[model samples]
Target: MDIFELDSAFVLHTYARRKIAFERGENATLFDQNGDDYIDFASGIGVNSVGHGNGRLAAAIADQASKIIHSSNLYTIAIQARLAERVVRLSGLDARVFFANSGAEANEGAIKLARKYGQNSGRFEIITLRNSFHGRTIATLKATGQEKFHARFGPFPDGFVYAADTEDVLRKIGGRTAAAMVELVQGEGGVLPLDEEAVRNLAAELKKRDILLIADEVQTGVFRSGEFTASIGYSIEPDIFTLAKGLGGGVPIGAVVTTKKELFEYGDHASTFGGNFLSARAAYTVLEILEEIKNSGKLARTIGYFARKNGEISAKYPRLFLGEAGVGLMRALIAKDDLIQQAVLERAHKERVLVLRSGGSRVRMLPPLTISKEEIDLGFQRLDSACRAADF
Candidate 1:
């Protein structure tokens, strides 16, 4: 049976799957069943940080798999301990780590930790910014600032308040507020970065009130945002930060790093598959590659190349693209309208290029960090062709 027929017959219809089927991938390029190459600008929605078909990444997973897959959380896992140390060092916090399976789980764990930290004071409220996107769980859906995602998922967990700005956060941060979480750059919210001044001010204010600040760096962590962490750029020292997406470099893993580790006693929280040996190995290797590229200065060069190519695309098609906004490779190109946006996406696919429609008029690009400058140029040229052929 064909892929479509097989999926339609058995699989659940969660996502609107495209017609094309990719057979394999190498670095920033994917080959379809027809042996056509498509320059991947989506990178599996920012999960393939080390790139596809990476030898080291594959080898690490394979080597760990041959040894062990899951031993549950009942026993100590050395790789998980090593990965926790790695995360703490990178976070620059006197912190402890908790591993989950996805960004949503990470945020959920963080919420629990923050509430536990303030439970003695009857403070369980978490204030998130409007237009921010968290995970999709019952608690996280309520934590998400956008009301659109909250429509059908009613009767959500309580104590999540959506704020407009720092001033609102301050006003809402009475005795009931335990923490305020933010996505340094709201990836699903059209890749909008928070205002620098506002983030810094909120950090300071939260610190003064002993209210925790969590940075949801699921899309911006592991050097995906050009910096090691987006909070560093905003000068906001977050009390806790969550990592996922690129953390496993295509494998599934999630982590919540917090400075206050004593909030929870023994057996307070645990995940059956969290920080298993295989996933921990993969995550460690991804972090190792990120460190090497960052130290050698290649990461910065590649990010600059991406920004430059973004400019070239907007310049070449002034009406098609209305500039872009993001840090590093996580950018969204704002189009004229929904018609032009959808048309360009369809045309880009026709031109053997992959991009994602983030919002109604925002085309998101989250290419692999290992993508070369030459690959950026080629992707832009193909994107230009797509834009030229696109018709509203």
Candidate 2:
């Protein structure tokens, strides 16, 4: 059977899958069944930080799979404990962990942690910023602050307040607030970043009010934005942080890390597949590679290059591009209209380059963190051609 036919037969039509059927990938390139190569900028929607089929990642997954695919959370998994140690150490926070399988799950776990912190006081509300995105889980969907996602997902759990501005946030932070959650950069919200001053002030106010500060670092973690977490770049530490997406390279693992250890009591929450042996092993390998890159100063050097390159691109293509907003590799190239955006994406694909659209209007690029200078140039050349052809 044809690949598309096979997928259409069983899979739910939730995602608008592109026409290409990829068989394998190396670095930022994917190959179809017919051996056609395409430069990948989506990086599995920012999940594959290192890249597709990375040699180190493959060996780690294989090694762990051979030993044990999974073991329940009832017993200790040494790899999980070790990974937790590394994450907490890098996060520069006194924290414990609760792992899950996706960004949404991580956000859910964070919500629970905050709620439980104020359960006795009946303060269950979470303050979320306008245009912020958390995840697809029911609670997170309601917390997303986007009306489009809230459709048909009700009756949602209550106590989610979408603050319009810093003053609004302060006004909304009264007796019911258990936590104030935010994303320094809203990945799915057209790549719009929150005001740094606003975020800092809000965090400070939340601290003054004794409300937990939650950073949903699902899309901005694991060195995506030049830092391990975007919160670090913003210089504001959160009480509880939700992480996933790029955490385990390509492996499925999400986690909630709190500011202090013992944030959540035993039996308060749990997940069967969270922090499983295999996923933890994968996370450890990813961390090891990150540490190596950091120690070599490669991480800082690469981020510097990315920022300079982003500026150059914006200057070179002023008409085709609107502007750029990003710290490192987590960047976006704004197009004027959806029609132009669609044309560029299609033309880019024809030229064997893959890109993704954010919120139907903007083109988002999250190439592998391991993408070299040569690969970046090649992909940009192809994208430039497509963008030029798709003049608005």
Q: Model 2 lDDT vs. the true structure?
A: 0.84
lDDT of 1 by residue, 157-214 (tens): 8899888976788887777899999998889888888788888888988898999999
lDDT of model 2 at position 43: 91
lDDT of 2 by residue, 179-274 (tens): 988888888877767788888988898898899999999998888877788888888889999889888888899999997567677788889999
CA deviation > 4 Å runs, candidate 2: none
- lDDT values for all models: 0.88, 0.84
lDDT of 1: 0.88
| CA RMSD per model (angstroms) | 1.2, 1.5
